[model samples]
Target: MAHPQPRTETSSDAALIRAWQAGDEQAAAELVARHARPLARFLAGAGAPDADVDDLVQETFIRAFRGVDRFRGHCQFRTWLLTIGGNVLKDFGRRAARRKVMPLDESVRDVTGDPHEHAEASEVEALLAAGLKQLPRLQREVFLLRAQQGLEYAEIAAALATTPGAARVHYHHAVRRLKEIVE
Candidate 1:
């Protein structure tokens, strides 16, 4: 008799995806656990109110699983996930706009060691957030994917469904505008 190998956390996302497709529910949960925080960060950077980030993240994963068959392996799974998340946020934004409810800027202020330093950092973050809101959708997405998530231009291109060159151009324009806004 042979013993079955235990599942390892080191499993690649592709393997997890395959297992999920095979109806292994644990695989889906694992994927969510692995990607949730990063996905939340991306959603929040894309202008999701802090309160809505969790719901948006859950919705993104739900949509991704529902449409898993449409995902080609052309990009990393995280990149694909982020793209779905962006769409989810956009849809939420539209609904929120229709309701005429303005989202509050409620980013948590770090109450840590140095009060003055924390205040300075929060001010910079606020300025950057304001600048991001002013950018066009594609430019904001490209900038957040690059500057916030550290995704390469090619991955960002795949996520945004644009050419890498176009992604780079958008990122450049975003950076230039942000400098003018934040500085």
Candidate 2:
């Protein structure tokens, strides 16, 4: 009996992109599987209210697929996807800011815990979210991309449409501001 060899997972993103373009649906799935959680984390940590995180992640993938032809491999695929995600977040924030009727999510208090502990944790989280909201969008994105997403300065720069040097500066400023916030 002949047995098939197991496939290796060493394919570069470029190769995966090519495969996806050639109608190999698994390649798209692989890309999404590899990146989706990180995108969600980045979105959440970058000031996306928790309720909107999943939708924003889905929208980022949708936009990336639709605009894949414009991707020139000038940077890593994850970097390009973060750029798309960042744009989506910016647009969402703008629309949200314009709409004064937006209602806050009422489900958070449903969790089981000592009310005082939960309230304290919620207050701290709200303060951190507010601090992130106060940062210039670039600094916030750079900080989350580097600190939370574990991207290198060059990758963060590419994702945020800036120089690596500028990314470093943004990260420093963000850290200082966030420390001021938490302290």
Candidate 3:
């Protein structure tokens, strides 16, 4: 009878990639588990509808796994995964544009006329969501990736297939516009 080799633990994502390439299914599962939540957060924060996020996230992993052999390890796995997420978002956006479905206005109403309370907060959130929708796609993506996902500019650049400098510029413009809308 043949015995399976024990899996080695390592901090390097490259190690995980090697293990995965060697047909260790656990390595693939670990990679997906590690990146899944952050990817979902990125999709949600980037304005994907609540109902579609899970589907999009699943699609991202499906695409990633299908192309796992082509992942050359030129970038960190997180960066690469986020790049895949961005591409998924782009595809979603294209489909949304074609469908021409306008997202519902998210204004939350309060029955009570309390001047300083939950209603104000809900109103602000609604306004912020609306303002975010007004931003150009690149700017909205950069802002959400940085602010919501806590991605550094370099990672944002990689995800967007742009330079870090451009990512910084987009973030700056997005912040400025959002501030104007809120204030």
- TM-scores for all candidates: the values are 0.91, 0.82, 0.75
- Ten-residue stretch with the least lDDT total in model 3: 103-112
- Compared with the true structure, all predictions reach lDDT values of 0.88, 0.82, 0.78
Per-residue lDDT over 1-183 for candidate 1, one digit per residue giving the tens place of the 0 to 100 score: 965345799998888888888798999999999999999998887889887888999999999998888888888999899989989999999999999989886446325767788778778988998899899989998998899889999988876778999999999999999999999
Q: All candidates: CA RMSD in angstroms?
A: 2.4, 3.8, 4.4
Per-residue lDDT tens digits of candidate 3, residues 1-183? 966556555546777777787887888888877888988877766667766888998899888877878787655677677668878988998898899975544443224555567567767876777788789888987888788878898877766679999999999999999999988
The sequence of per-residue lDDT tens digits that candidate 2 reaches over residues 1-183 is: 955333248877887887778787888888898899888888877777777888999999989988899998877898889878989998888889898536354335366778889888877776777788789988888888888878899877766668999999999999899889977
Error of 3 at 45 (Å): 0.9
TM-score of model 2 relative to the true fold? Answer: 0.82
Off by over 4 Å in 3: 1-11, 97-122
Deviating ranges (above 4 Å) for candidate 2:
1-8, 101-123
Backbone clashes, each candidate: 0, 0, 0
Best prediction by TM-score: 1
Measured by lDDT, the strongest candidate is 1
